[model samples]
Target: MTLFRGPVQAAPAEPCNTFAVPTVIAPIEGPERVVWEPDGPLVPWQVAGADDLWVEIDHTRDLLRRFEAEGPQPDRIIDRIENAGHLVVVSGPRQSGKTTLLHKAVHSLALRLDDRMRTWSNVEQLVPAQERWTARSPQELSHVRVVALAGPRNAPAHVAWAAGRPLDVDQVHDRILRKVRETLGKPEVEDGHPPGSEDLYVAYERLSRQLIEDRTVLLILLPDFGWGGEGLTGRFYRSCRDNARCGIVFFVESRNDTGCADDLRTAFGDELGTENVTHLALGPMAEGDWRDFIDARHRAAIPGAAIRVAAEVTDGAPALLTGASVGKLRKVLYAATQHAHENRRDEVDAATLRAVGRAFEVPGPDQFRRDGASRQQTEEPRP
Candidate 1:
């Protein structure tokens, strides 16, 4: 027994590296693999590692969908029109997605038309052409035609023409008619009619018939119509009143000034009594819609990363919800997560929210301080 137990060698201590307990280490030379635990407080290095977090978040699609759904409810508009002809004016604050909504409505209309036409036509060939037509000519009619006088620069020119300013309406009308003829692959008709004349209306009617024999639906997207003056609004209303067969005219205006609305009402006051001129005021996005948008953006940025904080920071403004970069957004979110983790919160808290907001370098009112408010009165709010 003494011989057998002569040397009870101590077992060699297992290497420290092979220990089962977790080891937190700083970055060292050579290939170092690091795994982070969600339970621990976020280290500054961890926050720094998420530098490109904002790159993952994109709320553009969500914002677009919301604007499309809320603004141009075509089915509702069509239903309303069943009883009486209605002029639905879609107005909103500048850059509030009015033009985008208009385009979405046009897209939906094209899709509906395509679905109905698929029953008869070669669906493949028709589909591509339909898509092209949606962009090229939103309003395709046999009897009437629409000329979209839009584009930031051109709209002002059209407004000037309508106001009987230095610009000539007849020339502008001829140019637009030529553009339409070219678009439809029809031979350009002579500029035979004078502006603001009965013949001008006749020529438009004839042009509409040449393109399509049925009644034509014409939609003129006159954005910032107020820029030209009160006279421009009056001229547009009169044109719509006179040209029933030429389809309806849609006037898009900014909602910043009640003056625009007043001008429009005054322009169409008489017509409003006998004809259907309706005003639609588009308000800001609903709180729920904004939250969903923020959540979507957060998921997009981080994939599986929890977005408990970014949503709180955006506060649901569509511009802010969709506009910030993913990396920046992620930094804010990571900071928020870290704050929450340290505070032993299962979810983000108000302090965490404020921290996230601060991380974004959001300026206070004083930082945005401006002088000469009276000087800014001359410039119209940007659309």
Candidate 2:
């Protein structure tokens, strides 16, 4: 994880994923208001002003832990996209940090592809000396272009793309075409050419061939992807697949609750059967990990608070973490921090969390345990 600022105090370099308090937060004047505002699909390090409350602690272990317990690591998914040149379906319960993992992968890829990082005279000052731009595979691509789009969950058919709404099919096509034109320049249309006669395919074919020849990778990320019948989504996927010759990879994100996984399986059964397409389902992590994450987030939010959050506060709040998505966890933490700020508390306590949980309808510890036990008894294992 790249830290946002210079270290005020040097701490012992603990092994990756350990809760060693990697970066010291400088004290802030007056009152601090911290919120986890997501700046699109870009990682915090890549986004300007998004690292105000950022900490250097690596949450990769948390992700890896979840993967080890629930599905294959994200590296395998990336490998399928990059090495095999296949589409990967990444499914998880909503708020399972699917975008977070993908953003991390893209950030690392950007770092590796940036030759300027190696050529800079003050490279150590710009990038941390400890940071490694290690190549993941032997066949390293020199260039990359990432186009991120999310699937419309409950969008109206009339809407194209709006501030909060996902992009529809037409908008998706327009965005892809715009990217192609920006990269490869506009193609001239013949004077007597008919409308929609192989122009789109020709453009994509040119894109595919140029990327292949230039050793550039085009990664298209489609998160929150749901199945809209053949006319809607089927044509979208089939069209891209038909035109893409090489150097194009798609990362499709979907919620497992929806029949999106089955839809993808049916649509691309051949690729799946051939192991060219892979699906990774993300699940929640252990309670201890959640506790650590909460503590880390708290420290990052407040900087130099008097004390860390009480452990029992988290231990007793399984309702906030158990089977809860990372999104919910962040919300709970955000509310608790706000509560602390409003109450002028140095550290978030049980009272602050309790009040926050009440607003979010989180159950008490006993009720959470009972529910967990019930789930264990009734729930079937996932294939």
Candidate 3:
């Protein structure tokens, strides 16, 4: 029943971690701030889509649960990821909850990693072969390493091989190695350091395999990988896919082409084989779907701020809510909740929503102003 067998290193003199360990991985050229840091628990509607107060919609809950439950289960989907890595394609229109869902999934996976690391710590000689794993603090969640596979718009500054020239596999390999080192808090060395093989791909393959040898999952986030008849992009995808032992999740905007997922599947299926790729698409939210989300926020997160929707508020009640997109809906509701709190209103009725709409300059129907609700719902704050 020995799950892990590695060389044991002496424990540190003190329990506290002395050196900087990579507890998080941010895109080298993405958002200026870290991805998973939450300041405090605020009203669910007050935060942006990517914020910690994300509402679990019907489509995303199941996938998120799977990530949370990711462990050493041999029969699960994660086992497939461990074998040859896996690709998850998430497609949605603009403002359709893509970023929110992906962020939630990554957060869930990190939590699972934290739990597994706790269990691993209880066993002797079960630590990773790498010395960096021995240097982490108990408070740090370092089991899961996240990195962006491709930057947004595939910018040249972020991706080294993304210039107008032909695809250089060595350049791609070197870029990935640098990011991985940066994630592990290791000092970056010059090209071909400790030169194993002249082939850079071989070097990258060995490092990736060793990094995940302790059952750690390297989660690669790729945003908006537009398919353009399999030119340099396809080569880049193939090069990365073939070399690394990492799980990749592609977030694509499907407003332009609804078949973006199918395109990716057909393109990578031959290389990855069948059942290794799963695609999830987020579309418009139904009335019941969004209503449940809002109600759940009220019941669980924001019980004090009761915002009852009027009966007249049908699927298209808030005319300013453009496209029923979750992102847009969240923004509008956040503004409404802010206004309600500022104005000292107990309930966010149609009138409050109308005021929010006017302030945001979101044109609404004339009838919406007349359909204000007279009743109110309230909840006392917990002592």
Each candidate structure's TM-score, on Cα atoms with residue i matched to residue i, is: 0.48, 0.59, 0.59
Clashing pairs in 2: none
Tens-digit lDDT string for candidate 1 (208-227): 45433322334444455444
Error of 2 at 141 (Å): 11
Q: By TM-score, highest first, what's the ranking?
A: 3, 2, 1
Indicate the residue-level lDDT of 4 in model 2: 27
The sequence of per-residue lDDT tens digits that candidate 2 reaches over residues 1-383 is 22224433322232121111122122476422222232222243233222323322234455434433443223332232343344545555445555655555444444443333222212232332222111122112235566554321211122334564445554565565664555444453112222352855555556665655554556666644333332345444544444443556565655443344566556565654343444555555455666666665555433233444666677675556554545566667666766676787766677777777777855333322212343333222321
lDDT (0 to 1) per candidate: 0.39, 0.45, 0.45
RMSD of 2: 10.1
| C-alpha RMSD of candidate 1 | 19.7
What TM-score would you give candidate 1 relative to the actual structure?
Answer: 0.48
Clashes of each: 11, 0, 0
| lDDT score, candidate 1 | 0.39
